[model samples]
Target chain A: MAEKPKVGCARPTGGLVGQPEARQEQQTSQPTKEVRTMIQVGKPAPDFAAPAYHKGEFTSVKLSDHLGKWVVLCFYPGDFTFV
Target chain B: MSVDSVFVHKMWNDHELSKMVKGGVPFPMLSDGGGKVGTAYGVYDEGAGVENRGRFIIDPDGVIQAFEVLTPPVGRHVSETLRQIQAYQLVRKSKGTEATPSGWKPGKMTLKPGPELVGRVWEVWKTSMEAD
Candidate 1:
């Protein structure tokens, strides 16, 4: 019977730990920053009023206006994107 | 929400979304110009001048019960969002006494949250329960 490998005993030495090239890769991989706000579950959602296009008419929408109903705010990158 | 202007939103709804969904989305398509609202929601990408794909489920009390942010390459599902809203409504109707299990749907069995349920959830719930 083969001995089982010990957990947390295998550490890569020359592999992407502290290399300058690895650091550059980390910086380049930084995508959008999504941690700017303190939004959290069970907390009050940030309120905002903005211009909206609804049902062939231009109008304005306020977050506070939908207080007594369930609101689903769907945000996307752009309008025409296929995603 | 996005940094796109309201004109663009209207054009897109008229030209594209109308063909996809009937009546071109029954809800408001807000134009978060300059990513202001997106910034407040933390979904704004300053470099791209657009908001990332995000969704927030706000209850009647204005509390954010759930949220999700995804990269632009991924699309969100309306069915999943609807399911979550129903689940949240059930939980709220029960006043937090009932908790929905994983893959729970409307009219499915829910778990009663209490000290007695601790460590014995496995006995009460099974993965097979997810199938209708």
Candidate 2:
């Protein structure tokens, strides 16, 4: 009979610790950062305010203007990515 | 998790952004054109145009409750947004009677909170994650 693995022990199957691709895949799956200091949970989000296209012209936007509202600040590269 | 407004880094070109309005997708898109907002948000990739995919969910009271940023190459998980939104609502509304376990979802059991509930929380967290 095969020995049973203990609780919190390694999985009996794939994605083993020695697999370098699996490890590399894990890192690659996350957001890449040029700098080492990656922002994380509980950290204060950086603030931003820029020109906004309201109806026609570019109106300015300040982060503090909406002090009491939920802001989902998202930044994307250019105008048209498949993103 | 849940937010009222989304301020995308960079300001947009009026004509270009207006073009997107012709499409079906909803939600305002800001174009951090000058990189000012991108710099402030830490989403600026100087050599790159515009900004990196940085997302933050700031609450009504100006507290950043949750944030997510992705590199240009990776796709952001919208499902996680839904999960976090539901979890935040559940925890905030429940008055500390329960705590959201890992990989929590809507209609699932949240562990009873407090020091007495740590073991139970871990169990729930494990089960939910396994199911995830």
Candidate 3:
């Protein structure tokens, strides 16, 4: 079967080029007891995280890191911004 | 929306999202409650906890348009999203003649560039960067 790069975790995320899920498995667990609002068009954007692109490369970027600053957590589900 | 959220990927501490932040992505990408953003955009599958691909055009007024959620495993295009922005911008500048065609780069062919195209927009998209 052709392996496609999975955008999120907990699945095969079969793309051969993706950062192996085994890597992130070492730290942190799932968040619970919170709605973790995914879509907020008008309200203040929620705080959440994922290893993100920083300085022209992927690094550990957390929302708490930007506490007191402005940030736009524009989330996508797949490769290269959707398409 | 004074504050906006745009998530192109999700890999907390993984190489991708980390690269984005380190690479000067200029934004933070929150988790979607196991794809909650997709769910909010009506694109997440309750069983899979992933998302469908779609363009959610939210006006600064906080109204949603073109909020079309996509199907399983498909992807979206940045250029297409840019086209939406282009379309919004054109409409704001006045009724122009540019529809922001496919692969429409900025400053490219916009409605053949001619007169008599009053109130006839070709590439007018909306975005938050617009002036009030």
For TM-score, the strongest prediction is 1
Ranking by lDDT: 1, 2, 3
Candidate 1: segments with Cα more than 4 A from true spot: A1-35
- lDDT (0-100) at residue A63 of candidate 2? 59
1 or 2, greater by DockQ:
1
Better of 2 and 3 by TM-score: 2
Clashing pairs in 1: none
Worst 10 residues of 2 chain B by lDDT: B1-10
- Give a tens-digit lDDT track for model 2, residues A1-83: 11222323321121112223334534774422322243455555444443443443324455556776556666666544565
Per-prediction DockQ comes to 0.28, 0.16, 0.09
Candidate 1: lDDT of A25?
38
TM-score of chain A of each: 0.56, 0.44, 0.38
How well is each residue in B1-132 modelled by candidate 1, as lDDT tens digits? 666766788789899888998888787777776565676678888788888889999999999999999989988888999999999999999999999999999878899989999999999999899776
TM-score of 2: 0.61
Off by over 4 Å in 2: A1-40, A54-58, B1-25, B95-97, B122-132
Models ranked on TM-score = 1, 2, 3
- The model with the greater TM-score, 1 or 3, is 1
| Each model's lDDT | 0.76, 0.52, 0.41
**Candidate 3 falls in which docking quality class?**
incorrect
lDDT of 1 by residue, A1-83 (tens): 11222223332111111213334434654422332455889998877666666787666677877899999988899978888
